[model samples]
Target: MTDEPNEIDGDLYEHHHIVVDAGQDLLRIDKFLMDRLPNVTRNKVQAGIKDGFVKVNGAEVKPNYKVHPMDEISVMLPEPPRDEELVPEDIPLDIVLEDDHLLIVNKPAGMVVHPAYQNWSGTLVNALAFHFQNLPEMKGNDGRPGLVHRIDKDTSGLLVIAKTERAMNGLAKQFFDHSIERTYYALVWGVPEEPSGTVYVNVGRSLKDRRVTMAFPDGDFGKHAVTHFELIEDLRYVSLLKCNLETGRTHQIRAHMRWIGHPLFNDTTYGGSEIVKGTVFTKYKQFVQNCFKMMPRQALHAKTLGFIHPVTKKKIFADSELPEDFSSVLEKWRHYIDHTD
Candidate 1:
């Protein structure tokens, strides 16, 4: 409904001190903040907690900390400079579906979802700010307009935007409930052992590198994540997969796929950039390299999204075609297998 909260750079962004209700039940502080913070995502709140920016009753608390009755919660974060504020840019958008209440856009790969510390311009948020005026503002959202969720910068997909606060609430609830239907097409290395199966793991920020997420199979840390994968095509050394997310944690599909020994194709972050399968011959390596050049980023696409309309109270479903790089690369694989075999 409103703009996304500003990035935490240096200046004080926000300072909130709230006293828990006497009847408050034991709820994770992260979840507590989700309901209290204006336009802030769970990941942001978790980051604050992880970075010691969040405290309970004057004591630093982890994300999983429980908020008890009469407890005091404080969150103070550094704000980006005034110049760091969002700047609308004139960027082309592939809008898939649009209505008075909401719209679904097919986001191309290589576009950041919103402005952050380094990427302050040329983001989807900036485009929305430019093309529309007076998008419903959610008090202290900082400024993403109506965006609620986001995909990775290099992962192309269908994303929904709300036009009103009512729509925002409705959509947010659907996401929280895992009732939103989202399916992704991921080109991964290695055919899975099973033609189709589900991967259940706990995914969280790597204690080693906070920027990237990883899987914690022990379930002691991180959030519960589930990704149901069905093998769609087998390309010998590689495979095409249809991944249905049961819980949408950060990089859930990527993390799960990597942990399951099938990292996405061309996903340098998760180690798929190398020739995970196929011969170690120079020519085979060159072929994989050529494929990587064909699709420079992770070979993943958000193919479908379905949810209940916020205002219309009806089911809305939309599907997106694979982008050029994805389709072309897949075609190349098809051709390679057809001829090389």
Candidate 2:
């Protein structure tokens, strides 16, 4: 990955272009893209086609138009809106590494990375704003203090905060170039077929539920996302997995793993809280429920992160230990699987 800008900007939208592979067969443009674009929907694509946001060979086409090999395609998608004001609060921060240019924080689960809507306080951004009163602001940031990226509120992990505009822009370019390395540890519902493999798919918000993300394996609709995962331990019904992200889309690992039929353990949104693999005996069910009570959130942790230091021109890596809730649940599963078998 190189440090070049990824998006081609228009007046109000971003442009995407693709050329049909030489060996590609005749397929509906909507169908072809439904399986390709990340976090997109068929309806969204069809709407784009109707509104002339999508074009084939420099001409706008309908949703049912057949795409042939070597066809040039382009689409214009609206840019994300600017964020709202950021209010500084006195939330505590678990500072891992801090210097003049940037700081890496070990964020705990259940803390929102930034303040939004009803989450107007107690966020990591609020903490940063309180601590760094004179932090530089990025363009179109509204009032976001020093954020270059974010993690899910329920996913605990390491996050890098930039203190200067040069650092922020440089780090953003690195992410756009896909040069950042992030690894996560997850307790999943079932063991993967292979000890290690990659889930290459498109990820997008579900049409049915906009709150959660979905994966498209047949190239339906979504942003491109890839997760390379390795099995660490098998606990009969569930397993431990280390997932490495190639593209950091929203809910990439969670949606990709769910697409592969192995949702993270205790992840209620993806059907991991239920007994997915164990027997139907009453004792087994009770044991599973007990495990859920022990760790109420999805069993995931951003264990490691690596990136190029913007100031030093050197590589920097940060690793975090699993929180008590996640590790304790793993121990319980190990004990239950061992004793019951």
The per-prediction tally of clashing pairs is: 7, 14
Off by over 4 Å in 1: 1-82, 137-141
lDDT of 1 by residue, 1-341 (tens): 22234444355453566889899999999988877765567888899999978878778898998899999876767752235466778998899999888889999999999887567788998999888766665444556788878899999999999888898888888998999999999999999999999998999978656667899999988999999999999999899999999888988898899999999999999989988999878888888899899899999999999999989899999998899999998998898899885
Determine which window of 10 residues in candidate 2 has minimal summed lDDT: 1-10
What does the lDDT read for residue 336 in candidate 2?
Answer: 88
Model 2 C-alpha lDDT per residue in residues 1-341, reported as the tens digit of each score: 01122344454343457788889999999878876664467788788899887788878899999999899887765654334457778888998888889999999989998776567788998899988977776775646778888898989989999999888998988988989999999999988889999988999978676668998887888888989999999887899999999899999988988889999988888888778897989998898888888788898999898999998998999999999989998999888877875
List runs of model 2 lying over 4 Å from the truth: 1-84
What is the C-alpha local distance difference test score of each model? Answer: 0.86, 0.84
